[model samples]
Target chain A: MRGVVTLHADGLSKDFGERSALRDVSFEVSEGERVAVIGPNGAGKTTLLSLLAGLQRATAGTVSRPPEEIGWVPQQAALYRRLSIRENLRLFARLERVADPDAAVDRALELTGLADRAKDELSTLSGGNQQRVNIAIGLLADPPVLLLDEPSSSLDPRQRAVLWDFIDGLAAGGTAVIFATHEIDEAQRHADRILVLGDGELIFTGTAAELHAAGGDDDLVVAFVRVLEAQGH
Target chain B: MRWLLLKDLQILRRSPLLIGLLVVYPVVISLLIGFALSRGPDKPKIAFVNEVPELQQTINVGGDQIDIASYSDRLFERVDPVPAATREEALQMVEDGEVLGALIIPEDAGRKLQTAVALGGSAEKPTVEVLYDASGPLQGQLVESLVDSTLAEANVAIGERITEVSAGYLNILLDGGSFSLLGQDFDILGLAEAERILGRQAAQLPAGSTERAELERIRRFAELAVENLDFSDEILSSISNPIDVKETPVGSSGGTTLESFAVSASVVFSLMFVCVLLAAGMLALEREEHAYGRLVRGLVSRGKLLAEKVLLAALCALPVGLVMLVVVALLADLDWGRAPLWTVGVLATGLAFGALGVAIGAVAREVRAASLLAFGLSLPIAFLALVPAGTVADPLYEVIRVVSAAFPFKPSLLAMDAALNETGDMWPSVLHLLGLTAAYGVLARVALRRFG
Candidate 1:
């Protein structure tokens, strides 16, 4: 179902004073493509997503679409814990300037499979359910491109499976999903393309099998490590 | 108890903000208030309507000429005088709050006083009017007392002058007389008898004689002069109390002192504390819960987001303010003067202080910090704003006035006073509140960008 490119970052660079957080980072994500940005700490994974979302100003770069057209989900819950799940969705939906907020909230709840607990406050929900509400807010505007920073870093195995399944549904519906993660296996299994970052630079961009051949290792984790080590990360 | 105390200490140690609120805030407020009290209070200006400035003439007093017309003008050192052109202008100044009270000296007052002093007596006494708003009893009484003291001093000076003139005339009369009785020279009756014989002789021969006509004029002059001296006792008594000082209450306050205080205190203090806490706590909670970032990233602009929070705070404070007013009205039987205007004043006060609270929240890093900062400052702000003009040193009061003017505290209080008391105009306060709201709103946005 992948089609024309829906997201493009060209020569993106972000600098905090003299130290660079992200430099010359470039990538293209097509509709329905799941791109995983894999990097160690301080490798600018979050910075890259923030730059693409226009929440931050890049030192030098350009994004193809306007910032409003892209959905951004940060690492934290970043929600009102006292409010119910449906209330949270409706508030964000209204912020997104959706034509019909109630309809948008309903769709987000159904898409996240959280309709049964829609009335439950986020503070009372389990970790996985809270994460579902987080993603639900990002999906409120139905942006063609979704950027999540570590979507499943804190979830259990079953919760992680539920999250990836939900993401797969979005991708299948022609929404390009970009996620930053430390899990190499997750990147290999779920990503249509893997972007390896080393010291604020893009070191590799290829499929899991192609990365395995280049890294001279069968295991995806070894390949990811080798890819980073080759660039002296 | 020791273990519990230790546990409480451990909890307190974790909150620097609470410690600051309990320790530093009080010390700072105390110092400020102590400093203000150390300086003497400034006097409010009283308007003076001198209608006889042109009749500035000197009269003889105890062998020395005194400028009687300028005596009252020189006696107003205790209270600053704002010279008004007319009685109407002076009263208007009081109504407009330009001056706390007005003193109106009626037309030809100087001429009348001069003539009375020259003739040594008069049938009519000139009166000056003192006008003040009855609703502001404290200020009104203060102004009235100052005017009374000044007029009393003027009366003493005039009485001394009159006594000196009478003494001078008594010496002249005794020197001119030759008769003596009971060890005191007495000649007024003998002189009157001689003048009566001269007038009788002159009348018999005054058909066509120039000498007889001259004798008649001399006799008439002597007779009138003796009669004027005979009335000296009455003149001396009247000179001691010449000017009539009348106190006129401009606007009536049907309530007691406690009722007036209830209206002003409830509006100013309640709105200030409530609106500030509500707005600051709201933003602090949002930041503490990690939702502020998400909110900023949404489609709403930073200004609009701040506006929404500030508006919510103000709206919430409005009911609290109204409830306090209603409760006080029920308990104290107070007249809320112009309900619609008072409501507007309350709402304006809320909006202004709510914006200030939002600014405080934006600068603070956590909920506790914001709460402490808002609560810690509200009481002092209210106190300084309501510290009745003359209660602090002139320089300190000037600084306080400037600070309160820049903010919405004093203006809102004054506006509410106008609305509730119907003593002056309320539009100025509303205008100031709106202006301050905009300024604080902008400050909140800037702080959010820097610290939020």
Candidate 2:
């Protein structure tokens, strides 16, 4: 909130017909901040990201960000199945109206380490490679902020480590990154600050150390399990 | 934009069903139309009954003179000639389907002509009856005309012979009154004298002037002759007009061959409009897949993404349209003289339709709903192309005409036809297609705002 805020959301809320998905949710991520948004399946972590990404309009809230300032990688890999890896990158570059699409695509492919398989169709790529392509698409416009949802969900441990390292490098380069994941260990490893949601409301906001010290009795996951057990889960 | 276009092109290349439909449809249509237009004859059996030997002789002579055998060979593969024992038998043959038709010469026909000639007057014409199955009008008419032509020639010949004999008898009566030949001629003269005496006795009773009666009779006879001649000429003209409008292929550019090819080409290209629906569905799928959310987060505006999808669909539609055009050209033997014009027209039409499809698809949330709506809207538009310009006289067709004029494919068809046949105004159709393209573009843009 102090540094030049990359994203600022105040009193953000969403309603679908009769059901409210989120209610007056507000948060801000400063420049180069690595934030992890964690919640149970229906706790509206996805909705928050969607609102932040400008995919859905808030019922009442204010979101301030420059156009094309955020790079989003969806939970599911959004790679075009019919297009080759390079072609998919090129399509995003062209759509973004990048002046030199070929160079932009080449750079993105190199960043994602998918340069070697540029000519291969997306369908032929493994789930991990496809995820990399999706990430590459988000990186094509070279936006200052990256928003990823469950980016490591489909990858193996090795692939996940590679992705975490990539995100760490991006953060080091002063690109703010916010990702949503259920994996507490991965979040603790990469995230500078962690935000937790429970039943459509933000329950916790602090660093991993603070969260662990507060729990005291066990780790973050163990604490969550004990809390669920107390509720007769 | 180029990348989006290239990606779509790659997808189109892999679709085998699309390729086959694009290439084969026009060729099949062309072959069907060609087969229908080819001249082929029908074979029908004919039976005849000739009670008078002279009548049969006249028919044989007339048939030989007209080259009936050669004509029949060219017209029909089989010409069965059955001789009936009696007039009733000939008629029965026709009823029983033993033959298509039968011609009967009356038994007293020759005797009646001879008596009328002896009396120094026009002959009582022998009546020839033609029996035919009413179920087959064309065949019945053909057989009837053939027989009638033969009878007409015989009548003309008999008329000339009777006129000569009457003239000779009159001269003999006028110059040589008392001779051996007089007995033969005077025997008929006695009956004429008796008939004259009876006419004079009847005329004594006052009714009207003889001159008036004679004038009225002459007028009636003249009217009857004119009516008969006109009727005969009308029938003959109708017969001649059969198959008169032979559609010769105008250097492979005109006639039913090209017309059918154009129709198939139009249909094939029209289907390319479905690509718009596919593009629309792709957009919907993106929303379902949460890709839109990702793009939004990536700072891609809704409008830009929608624009990109529309552009992609239009780009895809171009080659699909071209593939259809190429297929038609190769398979249907489409004349290449106007290929450039057709290609341009088809491309414009394809873009308009593609845009329209995207618009429709955008409104529906799922592929099933989008497909149903797209297909429903396009079916009526496609149907409009089937109605021939000359035959579209109904009020509903006029409405369809107005609506279809607003679609690029219809105008493209109109332009193509005009280019190939030079039958309609091409400029108006071109303008119409342009207007449709603009309208579709506007609609697509509007749809993006409403449903994007």
Candidate 3:
């Protein structure tokens, strides 16, 4: 709690027409904290990530953070096919008006382990490399907070492991890491705290041990199921 | 901004065909029109047969010389004339393929004139029997008028000589008052009225040396009248006169040809600007892939993203516009003085159109839709701008004027026209271009807020 508060969302809610995508959600993650938000499809996990990322305005609450302080890795990587890896990074750096772009780009590529493949076009790169470039683009400015929205959604198990290791390294380096995923097991392995969301509301927010102890002899998935059952998901 | 511009340049380098079409087509058309069609005089040919001596004299008086040497040369090479051995021969020639028409003068033309004089009434008309090929009736009519004018001048001259002699003999008995010639039915009498009046005035003068002063006055009057006779001729000549339009620049020294070249170049660049903006497909691709979500999470404000795209589009459009401007100027032999004005106008137009393309692309949901929408909107606008403002007409013209006022290319065209021809003020065109650019800027901002 003494660490710098990277993100502080209080009573965060979003609505599309009459349907509530996120309802009165509150969460906080400090520097060096790794929080995994897990939920079934349409349970507002992505919506909460969007809200925290400042991608969308919360209809009913305040989500505050430092300006230009968030780095995001989207679920699909979203690399430009027309651009080379280096060119894409260069464009992002230029658009963001990053100071000393050459060094920033080098650091991003080095961090993502894509320094050697920078010359290749994005279309020619493998899905995993492209995802790494996407993450590299996000990391170019060296922001204090990092948000990954199912960053490993389309990767193979090997690719996912590589991505997970990259995320772990960032969290270990004092960057506040917040990832949203449908993969409960992966979240259990990497998350310092797991927040379970059901029906547009948070059902559990504690360590995996506490979650398991509260619902005995059950996997984190079963425990989440019990929590959902109690909450009538 | 630099990196984004460089990226667009690289893309343009990769796609050479699109760039070539965008920049070359307008230049080619301009060169073709400026050099090839902008020459030569509007010459229309008329064919005639010379029969009466007076008719032949009138033909010589007019500037059009008879082209009678070779039938092929006369008819096919613009100056048409046909020849014949006799009056009947000429009529037959006209009926055949040899001539436009024939003018048949009566064999006893002088004798018929004498008979008319002796009888003191009009004699049988010395007919100018005109014959023509079945191709056109108008050509035959024109030939008739030519013969009629020749005969009319002859009759007037004969009448004028007779009246002069009579007036000289009668002036001694006349009182000094304005006298009107009464019942003078002879064509020669009417023609000689001016000379008869002069003769009568001379006779009425006293028989002394003062007659010399009267003679001097009469001589001066005749000279003045002759000079005044050319007034109708001057008016006629001025009516169909040609003017040489020349262009010069206030800021630079160059030739008029450079201004034309700049217009060509500007058109090429305008097209390229529209094409690249349409082809970039950045926003549509992002929306299609749902990557807007990613961009938002990266702390990229929508305003920043819009600015980035506009910067990229300007980067793409400016150089291509310059390249086209230079190439066209060189090829079209355009005046160099107007080059700066043309360059600025073309580049600004390109930027505005580029922004519009991006804004339209952002509204579209897919790349195909974006391309279709951008192209569909720009094609008509480009065509409207391409048409000369002077030639525009009707409701369509008004509509085009309003639409083109907002379209980037329109102001560029007007600016090029002014620069090339030195015909209008450059400031209005500059203001129009800026207004269009600002309008596009606002539209792009709205699009970014709603869709980016």
Docking class of 2: incorrect
Q: What is the CA-based DockQ of model 3?
A: 0.23
lDDT of 1: 0.80
C-alpha RMSD (angstroms) for model 3: 19.0
Output the better candidate (1/3) by DockQ. Answer: 1
Candidate 2 on A38-131: residue-level lDDT in tens?
Answer: 8788988998888877777788887787436678788888766878988888878887778899999989888888788899988898988889
Regarding lDDT, does 1 or 3 come out ahead?
A: 1
Better of 1 and 2 by TM-score: 1
Question: Per-residue lDDT tens digits of candidate 2, residues B368-403?
Answer: 666666765666566555443212223434555676
> How accurate locally, in lDDT, is each candidate?
0.80, 0.63, 0.62
lDDT of 2 at B267: 44
lDDT of residue B318 for candidate 2: 62
Highest-scoring model, TM-score:
1
**Native-referenced TM-scores of chain A, all candidate models:** 0.97, 0.93, 0.95
Q: Taking the candidates in order, what DockQ does each have? A: 0.38, 0.22, 0.23
Per-residue lDDT of B324-433 in model 3, one digit per residue for the tens? 66776678655678778766665555556666766676566577667766765566566655442212223344555676677766666556556555545667777776
Stretches of model 2 off by over 4 angstroms after superposition: A1-4, A97-107, A212-217, A222-233, B1-344, B363-377, B384-409, B442-452
Report lDDT (Cα) of residue A52, candidate 3. Answer: 75
